[model samples]
Target: MNFDELLSHYKAKACIVSVEFFPDGTYGNIRVVAGNKAHCDDMASLNHPFEPGCPYEACFPKNPNFEEHCYCCVHEGKPLHAYVDLYMMGLWLNMFLLPLDSDQENIGYCIYCYDVTPKADSSAMADLSADTAADVLKACIKLRGSGDIKHAFQDVVEDIRQICGSDHCCILLTDDEKCTCSIFAESLRRGSSLYPMARYIEGFYTITETWPGTLAGSTCIILKDERDMDKLREQNPVWSASLDYAGVKSVVLFPLRHGGKLLGYMWALNFNIDDVIKIKETLELTTFFIASEIASYKLLNKLEVMSTIDSLTGIKNRNVMNNYVDQIVEGQVPMPKAVLFADLNGLKRVNDEQGHVAGDKMLRKAASILQSIFHDGEVFRAGGDEFMVLVSEIDESEAQRRIDQVHYLSKITDDVRFSIGLSYGEMDIRAAMRHADECMYADKNAYYMANPELKYR
Candidate 1:
């Protein structure tokens, strides 16, 4: 073959790749045997001058996925294409491979071409084969059309499992700050021996922490056979041993990331290795949408928490308390057997003598003490320096004992004194709140009568 003539006809970073064929159906020494001028320029720009028959790693990074694609293209005699995010380089790569005629018996050849862009092109990403496009589009519709997000996630994971012909599929979310990982959704094929991920969730984050290093700048990890597993054992022994113990022979793992932050991981265990390329293509696109959805879901949850929680004291705010009251009034919720009102005795004195900062600290301390004592009840920051506790079921004796304990605990914390009043036994919650307020004022009056020097209007 006139390799130079073959090279002169092309334009966009094209090169001829040769793979050494073996009798045992394995490959060795993938090399870039020839290149067009554009490809040579690319190599020169990377400080690696073009050398015929140089190892593929001489110019590009060593990626197992790339190697697999090259081997498959040469042996299978088919064209292949992939659009991948090169996160380490902050680039998106659109690549293609086409098998070439080779006269030699011991070597197979293919032409590889690619283009790079700083950001993803949606059209290029959507240019998928009909089957892959249908599969990915179905997942997208399920994600966007469902009101129940958790159920939608379950359905999508099961779809992925079926598509991959795998024993199990799982989406695991990670919290690096807490060093914890949770199974967001998972589907296991019936009769499969794999245990549910929940059983190992106790310290799985430690294993998850090792994944980035094992991936080693690639976007995913695909262990298709024993050779790949051998490489994984060298890269990550702990995870490899865990997979071996779990009876996982083949797996595909992709990280769920949005805006450069890693949200979690999606993986399939014991998948059909014959369709590795198809599975990789499907998951690459599917996880992009999944990560975006998960990020939005997390943001909404955080906003809801902010709205319902007291910012200063970290307790339920008055808004949530009002909603609970409405539920009780509507008979949607059972009436509490006990209601207690606790008013800070001398917040104004603290603010006047020291500062509002000190008064704020005192309020937080008071809220903490109330939370510790009424752990079984609903504690709310009802008003400025006032808190309310509602117990769904408590006898009068136990209520009085808790009230006495609160008084004693407050007395010991000289800076945090409370005028507490309790209404025990089932009644209209509205009436209980009013009675508790009046009793609280009466207790405040008694405290002032005993210690007039510390009293404030």
Candidate 2:
């Protein structure tokens, strides 16, 4: 297409917004004259593919700024310019109203719009009129400002269901660790036969043949109606079966994404969004932010787990033990009525003779043995091949019995042997720790004496 051809195509295809105004500076209905197709081909380039004969109020629904802007141009009798940022529409529009001479001498103005959002979301258009965009933002703000902000996906979906007027709203969260899609939230038609609410509350669903999506390599999918069922089924048979059973007629899903990474999927059922363009624009505003928040939440949780857990033994680490000690010091815990320190035997030998991998296996096995004996107590991987158990509210007799059981189990196993030192009825944590450490060494010496073949540095 050459320049003139392209210009002609643009003039005919570009979204053109117009409104008639009264001489008193009041405006009549804003209408779509032409160029709605130009609005859909690219997101940032245009706006509402306004249906013919639709009022401006319908486009911005419930908002009067569009009319007022046109009225300003009519009163000025010259081209007037304005800037509007349609955030939810993913549009930063530079709008210009050119005064037009009408036959009846009534005032009229035409709008020229251009999108200004960053290029990340260029593939889609947020053809939401300014009013609709404002409504979407207010809902988002309400969600963010709710006094008792619920981090649950349910809260967000419920909020969206209201704004989108969908029969149902659902969110599926990605559990990367388990590679599963857990139903995070759902706000369905209260009595809808489609996937009764109970199914969503049934915990996680595995990411298998039963799920949906073939990773369309895109961020959004709109299933207008039954016509799209074939592709939907082709992508995920299991998901298709569930949808069919639920009596679902239509679906609109957006991949909760960040920087091209899909965090999960949020969708609306039976919505038939009156203006498909606006829904796309509205989601383009919220879904990615939702994805980013969830991603951050997961990252923080993973970091918390890593900080307090021992990767090799899958038990609390020294940091946790220190916290426990601090709790005792602060009287948060009852000074740990009993303290037991245990050290694995022959770990150095295992590491030297076999390998670090074997040593890791041995360490894990030893930790398990310690955990099994002190099942009722708090266990910690205090150091390399060393474990600690702090038992509170336990009588001396019970503590002794548990220790004897540990000794009996240790004697029955050759590889999973450890020395334990117990200090019972100790109110001062420091005294118990010292006494227990000394006792552990004494036991370690005796074990070596009995089994010289297992002696090590």
RMSD to true structure for each model, in Å? 2.0, 10.4
Which tens-of-lDDT digit does each residue in 292-352 have in candidate 2?
6667666877999999999989999999999989988898877878899999888888889
In candidate 2, where is summed lDDT lowest over 10 consecutive residues? Answer: 1-10
- Show where candidate 2 strays beyond 4 Å: 1-128, 135-154, 175-177, 188-215, 224-237, 408-413
Error of 1 at 309 (Å): 1.6
- Error at 285, model 1, angstroms: 0.8
Name the lDDT of candidate 1.
0.92
Error of 2 at 71 (Å): 30
Per-residue lDDT over 288-317 for candidate 1, one digit per residue giving the tens place of the 0 to 100 score: 899999999999999999999999999999
Question: Model 2 scores what on Cα lDDT?
Answer: 0.67
